[model samples]
Structure formats: C-alpha cells, structure tokens
Target: MNKNFIIKKNREGKKEDVPKKIFFKTNLFYKEKGFLKFFIYSPIVKEYAFYTLFPNGLNLFIYDKNTYNKYTYLRADWVKSIDKMFFHIKGNIIIMSHKGVSLKTEEIFWDRRKKKIFNKKYTKIIFHSKKMILYAINGIEASEDLKKIRLKNINGTFPVK
Candidate 1:
C-alpha cells in the first residue's frame, strides 16, 4: 500500500477539479508509520489556526508525551454538542474514508478557555453521551495508568524503538 494521502478542506466545498497546489501542500516525512508533513497553501490560514484529525487518520498526537490529554480522541462525529464558545473541543472527522476507516471517528480538538491557562487545575473539556460517560471515564483511567508505565520504562533508559 502507498503510504501517502492528502486532502484539502475549504468553504467553497470540494475542489476536486482544481490542482492540489491550489489547496494543500503535503509532504510525506515518514512513509512507514504515517508521519506527515502538512502545509496549507490555501486561504484557510487567513482564519482559524487550528485543525483536527481522527485517530484512525492520526499520524502523531500533539498531546503531551505522558498524559491522556489527547483532545483529538474525544471529538467523534457521532456525539453531539462537543464544542462550545467560551472553550470547547471541536474538529472535523473523516466522515467517509476510502480505506477501512470509521465514519464516526472524531477530529482532534483542544480549546483552552482563557482561564484554563491560568486556572488552578488546567483541564480539557470532555463531552460524551449519557450512556458513554462511564466508558469515557474508564478510558481516561486506563490511559493515565498506561502512560505512567510507558513513562517509567522510558525513565529506566529503555530503548524507545
């Protein structure tokens, strides 16, 4: 399989007929495990400074190396009201993927309230369906524990590879 993929999002809808340069300029930094070098050559840069990606479409997470603050994982499209104005996590998911990707996957989001930066406890907004709230909580615990173990191993000078 070719380890390369790119897509351009725009307000004018899909620009399927235009040249790729007119939209996005993508570079493949690592073709093996899907590391990417993405650059926007379009007009979106004139507006918002953030973008989101689904975990299935994820290359590398911007979350802290030792925390469960992957805001990207919490924005699945199936859920409702996941974003807010004062501060919220919102991103566009890959609704339709060519490969075996889930349309319900969420885009990554990390919106910090003005106070979040200076707050006593820096926190990220987590939204979930009433039924899935427990699942989300369990995920957080498991991720925190796993991160601790991974961090301990690395601290022991274990090989990263």
Candidate 2:
C-alpha cells in the first residue's frame, strides 16, 4: 500500500486507506443556541481523519454575539483546522474589522475560545479612522474584532491632526 494512505481495518480484516471527503465551492455556517456565530467559505475543502484542510483558499466572517451583526472578516490562501477551537492560517492572510481596521500577515493562529489571532511573523496593521499604518517585525496579538491589539518590535507612522 502507498505510504500516503490512511490505513484502516476493513470489514474483511484487511487494511484499507480511509477515504478522504472533498468538497468544492463549499460554504459552512455555525450557530450557537439558534444564533448565527460565523460562516466559512472555501473554494475547495478536504476532510481527513484528524483535520479539515482548505487548500485553495477560504473566507471567514464572524458575527457579533448579541447584535448578530458582522464583526470580522478573514481571508487566507490556505487554512487548516488543528482542532475544534484552533486553526492554522497561512499565505497572504488578511483580517478586517467592521470598524475600518485591517491586519495583514503571512501566517497566523486563531483561537476560537479566546477570540484571538496571533503570529510571530511580519505584520502590518492599518487604522483607517486614525489614518495610521503600523508594522511589526516580530509579530502581533489581537482580538478578533481588531479592537485590542499588541504589537512587538513595532514601528509606524501616524498622520498628525
């Protein structure tokens, strides 16, 4: 058998590779207690035994807990769900908030439980309201809503009012 196969025991006591489930142009929505929490759209998605992979690209939209309004938007060239509460996002990652704040990075890790996104890579943050741009060489930690942010080794420019 090929090494890439996910071997499993068949009914006949024979080893077989577990079939992978794949979908194209997929849209998934999550809800909690009848309230819509978030939505995920992917050009292509693959389901393995332990993880879900988005090979092409994915867009995520999170909704406000109370108002049910759009809170944040995330886009990435590739994404992998490490588990139920954590995801690995990579390749031209962009996160935006409804409040006109945006963040750009090559990679990041998102924690659903904490509602946080973090990375130890080059990152750029733009605040449209303040007309400022910030760059972080060492990386950044921020809330999903882009309200609270922490940047490491930061240098940036702000327009003087």
Please list all clashing residue pairs in model 1, or write none if there are none. 72-108
Instruction: State the lDDT of candidate 1 residue by residue for 4-121, as single tens digits.
Output: 3344567887743222122222222222235332211112111122322221222222232333332122222221112222222223432211111122212222223321211111
Per-residue alpha-carbon lDDT of model 2 for 25-137, expressed as tens digits? Answer: 99999998898888999999988767788989899988887556657899999998866688999999989988999999999998989989899999999999989999999
| Residue 59 displacement (Å), model 1 | 4.3
Estimated TM-score for each candidate: 0.19, 0.85
Q: Mark the regions of model 2 whose C-alpha exceeds 4 Å error after superposition.
A: 1-19
Clashes of 1: 1
State model 1's lDDT. 0.23
**Sequence-dependent TM-score of model 2:** 0.85
Steric clash pairs (candidate 2): none
Candidate 2: what lDDT? 0.88
Whole-model Cα lDDT of every candidate shown, in order:
0.23, 0.88
